[model samples]
Target: MFIMRNISIMKTFIRRRHIYIDHYDLSSTGISLNEYHQRRHSLINLIRNYIKTEQKQSSYNFTICLPSSTRLFMGPDVAYFPFKQQSDFYYLTGCMQPDALLLLNGNDETFSTNLFLSSCPMNSINDYERWYGPTITDKDKICQIFGIDSVHSIDKLNSFKIPSSSILFYNSQITDDTSTNKKNLIPFLKNFSSSIVCNQLNHFLHSLRSIKSLTEQNLIRHACQLVSKAFIKTIKNCKKNIQNEYLIHARFQYECTKLENTSMAFYPVVAANGRSNILHYQNNNQPINSDDLIMLDGGCLYKQYASDVTRFWPINGRFSSSQQQLYEILLTVQKDLIKYLNSGDKFITRGKLNILTDQYMIKYLREEFILSRTIDDDHAKRIINYLCPTSVSHHLGLDVHDCESISFSEKLESGNVITIEPGLYIPLDCTDVPSIYRGFATRLEDDVLLTDQGCEVLTSMCPKEINDLYRLLDERDNSDID
Candidate 1:
């Protein structure tokens, strides 16, 4: 049985500014080792239920293999990109180090856990100490920290044995493929006889990951709040006098990084003026015009959870008549979508919302896009299709688009966090849209948590209201003028 023990006997090490204690404390990450243990237990039970109900097998042994992410360099002999652990690996074991493996082996009722990590002698002048600095090589420290049955050197992985009849749960997509077969796991399992059953581990893990624990929800909520505040600062920083899109991008980055263990969740979309017509426009180097609308889609990663949001405003701190009309319409539509999600009319799902998005867009396009003329149903459909071609929402969590394998058609359950992003894009060259709306693009996004009571908009603190956005920039503009 795996039990927490005193860490007095474990060794400690330090490299540069980081310290490795005998006991690994994960409090800063806002998740507990006990939660990780429960995750593993849940996965095991999930597998067990599958075998009993679907397979109808009385007895079976199974091994689940999860490998830590490996480091990758930018180019030949260059510095590596920041190391990001595979989400599923981090989910099961709170071990944050690279080049490690976790194995859960046992029969239907119980299992034993083993963690394999790269190790070097404590006092030796080996590669670990010379080039990379100190690593956690102490087995007892790791065992107690991660609540595993035992820890061993990764080099000994091939020597370990499991029941020949054991079902093997492994997903190569989630493991480091750059590693060799012996080190990577998919090939290591091949060493066993063909009688060893192979299963796609992602199936079980994604099902579990789709639901957010209260701890996870808090992490995401914090991330959303951070991004919301950062957006306000970014808008204020760039108002009136800012010249280029990259300056806006840099300002947002600076604001986000002021907090520890936080960074942009993805390369932000900082589109100015006509560039906004291109959805996913990340080449944030174009010069901003005084009267042009600036569209920003960005988020932050707090701990490992992600929050996504999008907002649009006039670069001059005041929207033009056309920009104001289009922005107000889209903002209203986005708010209505969020309200519909929480309406509890029926069991809702992303798939249904996706379909409803088109309907809603068409309705708005016909009723509001043109004040001088009323568009018929066929004309409105054509205009909506040409202007907006993206889905309204997707699930959000560890990865920006978390649980992608989980179908959008699946019901929206409590403890699930998702984003509602409705966007409108009108290219200058496209004649389908009215001339006044041409070359304008904008999206309003918010992270939402589905609870039994109702859906909570996690990013509401981020100002998406037209008047609020105006006030933020107007105050900055006034201060600069004074």
Candidate 2:
């Protein structure tokens, strides 16, 4: 969930200090400029619908500030990131400028959606454009680009007086969310008139983002294709020493951004040997030993949407007997889970129980003799967490782990983009574990889009079948032969 995107740039430092960017690209594809107008109207309508159902009808105004990371301080002349518009704000306003704000006011008949541009430190209106690149300065042109009804300067945001009774529907996720990695928005609200109250609209935004629009799905699918191409390159280039963990990581980055031209969605997990057992293991510096069955978890960003996929490969172009044994069983479990998904049963639901229980994986593990016990008893079931440490699925979109507020247990809905990953971690050092499956760690992750009849595996082009992987790697090993 906390996968970091590390893109290659010509340079990102000043003479004084080095700077790291969180996200360097904010391009939007598939989503047309005209579609933003529809989104804005839908969001405002959602707000109005929410207020109408409230115990008491309330008058309110919406306020969303661009994420502070948009123009992070690096050095005197450096900015780390390329002005990534905040997800929620962009969903509603489609504006990409830094330090800007969008206000949807019900009290004013002037305009429902008002854009407030933050002035520069030296009173230069082109502050963001000066650092990022050329940007439209004409107020009307800016409005035309963003599909906003009105535009104003942030200097006048607080001056527009509102009565004490009106509420501010705020999209600042939380005052205590330290993950933003920059200043939170709560303190900035002190500038607002004390008469107005700020109520968090975080849940409303989450609910909206859970269901992907057609444009968002297309963007995510494009990212998935890029991921598949990058993965294929990594497979074809594998070597004993030259293609270690970092090589695989570099291949993914290069193929996605350099060849296909996209951005790394997160820091890739190029885990080999025992490293795969450590979930979220990102120290991609490990060697590709003769026996290491490497686990690669990498994807790229396309048009502000994310693709996440996980694959396992044997460095020597063949899986060991133990590797084959475990991979076969695990692959079956993953397929069964996916089959169930396509059967109209909610992803993690089995009548009333979560799918991770002995209901599916545990039963299969025991049937294949992979697990010592089936986790049938209460005690065995309690240890289910140890077997598969990560959840079966998660919401995926602009953020790899999108729709944080929604519980995965709920029934799957159409337009929901989620990830289905089933992984196994067996400790090699533990003598209690059977030698056949010892030190075995395998995770098969696929990005899934829930559709009307079933689901679509968006990242399917990257082959995962044991036989398929073996053939591909063998072909690659001899690709240069005459």
Give the candidate number with the greatest lDDT: 1
Q: Model 1: which ten-residue window has the lowest total lDDT?
A: 14-23
User: What is the RMSD of candidate 1?
Assistant: 6.6
True-structure lDDT of candidate 2: 0.67
What tens-digit string does per-residue lDDT give for candidate 2 at 317-408? Answer: 78877778778777887787778777766444322324542456667666666556734556545445566677767788877778676765
Colliding pairs, model 2? none
Worst 10 residues of 2 by lDDT: 13-22
Put down candidate 1 lDDT per residue, 1-482, tens digits, no spaces.
12323332232332221323222466766888789889999999998887788777879888888887765678976846555777888899877767778888989777999987754434333444666664554567767877899887676677788876777778857544774324546556775546545457887888899899999999999999999988888887776768899998988888887876698789899998779777778899998878878888998899988999998888777888878877777887888888887787568989887777777777666576452246566776666777778888888998898988788778888999999888888888877666887788888899999998779999999998878987898778544311
How accurate locally is residue 165 in candidate 1, as Cα lDDT from 0 to 100?
75
Candidate 1 regions with alpha-carbon error over 4 angstroms: 1-24, 120-127, 130-134, 172-176, 180-186, 196-199, 369-383, 478-482
What is the Å distance of residue 480 in model 2 from its true position? Answer: 7.5
